[model samples]
Target: MNQLTVFEQREVLGKEFRMYGTPEQPLFLAKDVAEWIEHSNSSVMLSKVDEDEKILMLNNVYNQVSTHGGVRKEQWFLTEDGLYEVLMQSRKPIAKEFKKEVKTILKQIRMTGGYIPVSAEESDEEFLARALVVAQRTLSKKDEIIRMKDKQLEEQAPKVEAFAHFIENEESSVEFKILAANLGIGKNELLSILRNHRVLMTDEYMCYDKTLGKRVKRYGAKHNVPYAKYDRFFEVKQYPTDKINRVKVLVRPKGQEFIRKSLVKHGYIQERAA
Candidate 1:
């Protein structure tokens, strides 16, 4: 909710430059950068930069920059890439140090939200110590971001568990013989028990056969599954065949667990610990 200032006057090394835009995407006044690198009039060396990297902005937009003389109708600003390209043009010995100061000042703005120029009288040791602080702060920001992500995943834990429960209790299922194969048991043995108990059924019906073009009698594999507890253990589904439709009883994950428990209790199989 805090607003960021559009213009900042930063003293980099012994020279000064006016910075614009946010710390993450900083831009510089092309004229200031042009003079700092000692490009004295042969077009100020700014014209050497590629057209795409240099941009023209309305002076009135960043009013803080033009308070004294009022902003120009239009002024040139160098993009981050453009600034670097211009720095590489200067053959002056001080150009190398100027580049370093520009880099460090921008980094300080990003990490600390402000810049503290090196004091003219400060020892070399003091400068290094200050630079170290900036590096440490950047690392701390990265760690904070990682922790926030971990907390988000923790908050979503219950929703993920609920979805897994729904698969087991409702949607997940397999056909009768497929279930038998998955359970590593004999299909006919399980079929015989269910039929004898009247828990499942089969019947014969006739319908138009698409292949033979006639009504032919066919044995319905599953006429229907007689519900003992309202499909808690199994669901009856009718789906299309090549020529017609057929019924199938699908056993769910919950039903599979129930049957496995029953088999163990009856001594038909050993209880498998999972």
Candidate 2:
């Protein structure tokens, strides 16, 4: 929390506890929470908290608490949910009061967007307790707009990364199976889709192979022929060695994008999990 400094302490609240986190989502020092809840071992108390709810901060030369100093080298802070979990797990009599106090403070801070009200009768300790909330009331309109835009970008990060991945590949040509994998579709499934959309045809017709002078059956290769929109996107190579003398389809990089969009429009492409 960008806490309102009590007695000129930014990270510490009235020397009672240390806070770390944005005023919007305040976090507490694990040791302080443990001591308040009467947990004998801070390490043991934190073991029950989820990994995502806890973060470790290490002391460094840049921070006021230098590594060369005799101070503890590391600290563990708990998220609001984690703090609540620890309080509920504690059997101490003060745990209930501590939970209620923290909940009330958090509620006020969140409701007011990190600018909580102070009461005339508020004690020094009570004021410090609510100090975890940052006062954002003075933020400029431009900064607020930037913050909202940043939040939107954060929410769209997964989609942005996916599109980047799709567009950044340098491969000039990709085999059908490999292209299908990149598109998150099975090889056979993609082949079926192509056939269903008439992008591929498998009708057997008589054709003369150079190796075999006589007439031989060959499957249709519409994607390699004219009048097809996606025809240029595909490279169909005739394999005359096989009895059927079938064609193997390969996709160019631009063709991959075209096929991807087409498949997406036809509801055939598999969506990757965000």
Candidate 3:
């Protein structure tokens, strides 16, 4: 019902077909019109309807079978079947809506027949870069979560190490054990005490250093622990201090036997008591 313009056809098929099918815009000639018609799986074909080749057949349904005239005007005329096919080709408005419709349909059919399927894998790095962008975003989020967990552990490290030490070496029954179980002092603080303070050892006994008396006194006073003359006093008492310090047990007449036992125990005098 309407005349199709060169601009309208170009809009549907793109600029490649700009000069196709008009006085100023001559359409591309098919390589073999007879072969195209003979092998027609679709209802339309493009063929020359005049000797000058200016006029073209848009459809050939009836004349394709009839022998009335060779390449007549009726053969080139756009048929109802051809117009139906053309409207299905593109949504763009065209001049001589009926004729342009047939041309549009024929153009689309020819283009589609020549089309080859494209492989997505052939795009290579373009697709890969898009994929990596998404992956990096996810990895960055995971890294942030890991850093947060590490910071929390760092803040809690001293508390965790203190609890582990209590479970490990607290059975030694050192005064530090009582202090740690009650007050929660870290390992570094306890190590500082052992280094600076004089620790006297006995068989299951405790004694304080005579050298660091002031330090022990100050430590106990600051912490509200009872301060005494001996920082590590023994729980069990054995012998007199003077006699135990003697090298010759025979010099002590009152506790000759005790002296001999002490000397033998210490490996100072080896005579067995008779």
Q: Which stretches of candidate 1 lie over 4 Å from their true place?
A: 1-6, 42-44, 61-72, 117-274
lDDT per residue (tens digit) for residues 1-274 in model 1: 0111344575655677677665777777777776787676635576888988776543333443332222123356787888888877778877788778778878867766556676899999998788777668656865775685466446544534443354455557877676555544567666644554455674668899999999998776455474565368887778898977876787877776676555444333333322
Give all candidates' CA lDDT scores: 0.62, 0.60, 0.33
Per-candidate TM equals: 0.38, 0.37, 0.18
- lDDT string, candidate 3, 76-175, tens digits: 2333333333334434453135345345545643443211223466576675565566457546755774685467557545644554454455443333
lDDT value, residue 75 of candidate 1: 51
- For candidate 2, report its TM-score: 0.37
Q: Sort by TM-score, best first.
A: 1, 2, 3
Ranking of all candidate structures by their lDDT, best first: 1, 2, 3
Candidate closer to the true structure by lDDT (higher is better), 1 or 2: 1
Maximum-TM-score candidate: 1
The prediction achieving the highest lDDT against the true structure is: 1
The Cα error of candidate 3 at residue 212, in Å, is 64
Cα error of candidate 3 at position 73, Å: 88
Give me the runs in candidate 2 sitting further than 4 Å from their true place.
1-18, 59-72, 113-274
**TM-score, cand. 1 vs. native:** 0.38
Q: In angstroms, how far off is 88's CA in candidate 3?
A: 52
TM-score of 3: 0.18
